[model samples]
Target: MTHHNDGVTTMPPTAAAAQAHRRTLLKAGLFGAASMAAGLRAPAVRAQAKRFAGVTINGAAFQHSFHAALKSWLPELEDKTGLKVNFELQSFPIYNQRMDLELSTHGSAYDFCNIGTPYAGRWITSGWMTQLDEFAHNANLTAADWEPGDFARGPLAILSDANGHIFGFPWVAGAIVMGIARSDLLEKAKLPIPATLDELVQTCLRTNAPGKTYAFVNDQLHHWEWPPYLMNEGGTIFRQPPTDLMPMLNTPQAIKAAEIYTQLLSSKCAPPGVLSYTDDQSQRMQLAGRANIRTASIDWLVPLAKLKDSKVRSTVRYAPLPKGPGGSFPGVNANGFGIPVGAKNKEAAWTFIQWALSKASFERMALQKAYVTVPRRSIIATPQFKEAMTINGQDVGQLYIDTVDAPGVSDYMKYRNMAVFPQVGEKINIAISQIISGQANAKTALDQAESAAIADIRKAGVKL
Candidate 1:
């Protein structure tokens, strides 16, 4: 065996190598309680060992709970599934660019990869995704412990097409967009927990004490960051499903949402330099007690709940995002595993997916708090996970559930589901940048965005 510096190890395709792999795994402490559970059923898997033996599957590195599992659990995983995986971690943008080229050329560079749910539709439509119906239906390929029905319906739906061709296994179920507030600040300001965006802003403004404290903070660095506000107010970057797709961002509803968003930033209720903050910085300020409220992805709450040095550890509270006049809407996004159409080792890939997402695996990972949102209901309902998901003794699962089930929540990939996402998303980002920089009003910026989006769609040969 030759160990490669790029996180890969090359081994001869022989029984001896397989035995050595098992030995390496045991030394790495892969046989924990979880592996014991997996071990009991290892014999059943051996019945199909020939299918995956000597085959190497490749996957991109994703910043997900699955990543934690991939790093520490693969030996046990390979032990049971008889497949070797080369895990490559990279930024999503760079990974996606490389994947696009590979997928476009039908290259078999990776047998398995992680893909955002928003791009599920585009990949399936482009014939780059392997429809998973057959693999899922195979008993040898699926474990009874991995119940398909246990997965949350919303996430499963988005990862599949209208005809029910699933593109991949749901790997990451992020919490719906929600707000985390400093409970102490809300009490100090004598403000009720806000239920609308306007109320949220007002609460922030009232609670804000200038240099002593800040009121609100959000990540505005990405174009998708503000769509929760837009959707809550009956605005959309594109028309909703079952309707013809077109840009509706320049409308009155969107302009109003943009105005409110900018006002919250410019009013100094939030800290300075918020326009450049990403998810980490935005959440850090609130956890550090620099801000009273932070609106963001639900997943952030998990780390906040566990942070040892967090100033607001006991004071953080989770709730659905504040509503707009139209209603409360949040953003929902998903990350998961997909098999490429060109994959040479799809059987091994399928085997890997099954083992990785099995009920036993999910339960073990959840116990470690590896992922805040496990897509499966059974896993989240487990006593271990229920206890782990609490904040300051409050079971915040209901907040996550309600936000996920909320009607009209923006699917984080709105325009990205179409093939023109790269171009259109960039334009949308530019438009919001103009608004944040005071170079253009909402109407003018969104108008330009709308035109750019249309042109991109036309260039892609996609008819609305």
Candidate 2:
């Protein structure tokens, strides 16, 4: 399978090879058998040797900083808990599917797992997760210190239940609505960098040179990308106050937004293959100088910088999502850590979560991976962290700092079936594609997508 620039590749691993990898990991643990055994059984291990032993958790294949932090922290945890902690990292899709299957069986395959905000509701309702309220209270971990409004009640709240029972701790926190552009290309166009959606679209149209360069591109199929545009137009997918499901796709504001997006393709402002462009494709286009603008997580900056001979290196720029009617609306994405309901070592797991999320640990992790942003408000404000952000070549650290301190947008998830948003998103993409290809009229495509979206929501058993 071809790998997209999204830093993810799908390589079909032979069953035998996979099993061998697992066996290899298991054998590696055996080298420290005495330590591992004592670590597994809490009381038998010595205090110094108890950091982390016999504890196993699973997380998706996150970026370097997170994985590197886990490598550093796991040993410390083993020493503290006298339990051996192991992490099984897999791709996001694989992890999501495996987690769902394991939860269905209430399997003990993992004591802890990293879950996204979207799946939090279903996981908690199904009794697959353990409540972390008591743990928080006991640890004297005040919500005030963590920017709960920005980090919790907003986006991260999707990982909590309706009654205020939190099932997870915020692991990775950052905005998902920043624009990345090739500075070299923008200079060549002699245009000021766009700080608003309108300016961005206009820039794309002005700079587009069909056979040479396209203006902007992205993975149009993902539902998450739509909200920034919606918010920019003073519209929302679902209105608050009972959170009624609004078919924003058919709204005039959405139609307008769709027109702008479709125009990029229809007017030749983007590459001909843009409809099939994934996130990685967007990244690659920007890196290769084939496109001028894209949206990406801050985690991508490091990898982009690492591309030594790339023309865009050191010349790439990032800023918050451009303003629209709502004026610079940005969306946030987060990874959450949760303990399984069936976990045999709840206390140990909680201890690790608490320790890992502490200010000191967060700082250490952020520095090791050169992470530009850390979820903890306190960590970001520190001088050391500011320096680290500078070293990472991020000019928007203050933006992230202010955003995390007072985040405007929140994380969102659809009803349990998950198919609701994606299905609707797909129809919308199809309509946009057709319009771009001149196969269908814009209004007709929007109308068809709106109808399909409402039907899908009903089929998913959502009340709205």
Give the winner by TM-score: 1
Q: In candidate 1, what are the lDDT values of residues 60-161, reduced to their tens digit?
A: 745554676666788776675557788887776677777777888888989988766446667767889888878887788776667776777556655676
- What is the alpha-carbon lDDT for the whole of candidate 1? 0.72
Put down candidate 2 lDDT per residue, 1-464, tens digits, no spaces: 32479978575468777677668757766857867676676455455454444455543333445765675667766666665666677766677777878877787767777766445555777788888877777635343344333343333554666555677878676565454456666788788888777787888888887777677777654355665676677766654422565566777887777777677565568787787877777777766777767655555543455456555666767667777876655556567788888777777666666666666667777676666557776677778777655523764666665554444333333331132445555666677777777887767888888888888878877776
Cα lDDT for residue 15, candidate 1 = 85
Alpha-carbon shift of residue 189 in model 2 (angstroms): 3.4
Candidate 1 regions off by >4 Å?
A: 1-51, 63-65, 240-243, 405-416
Candidate-wise lDDT, in order: 0.72, 0.64
Candidate 1, which ten residues in sequence have the lowest lDDT sum? 405-414
Q: Find the 10 residues in a row with the least total lDDT in model 2.
A: 410-419
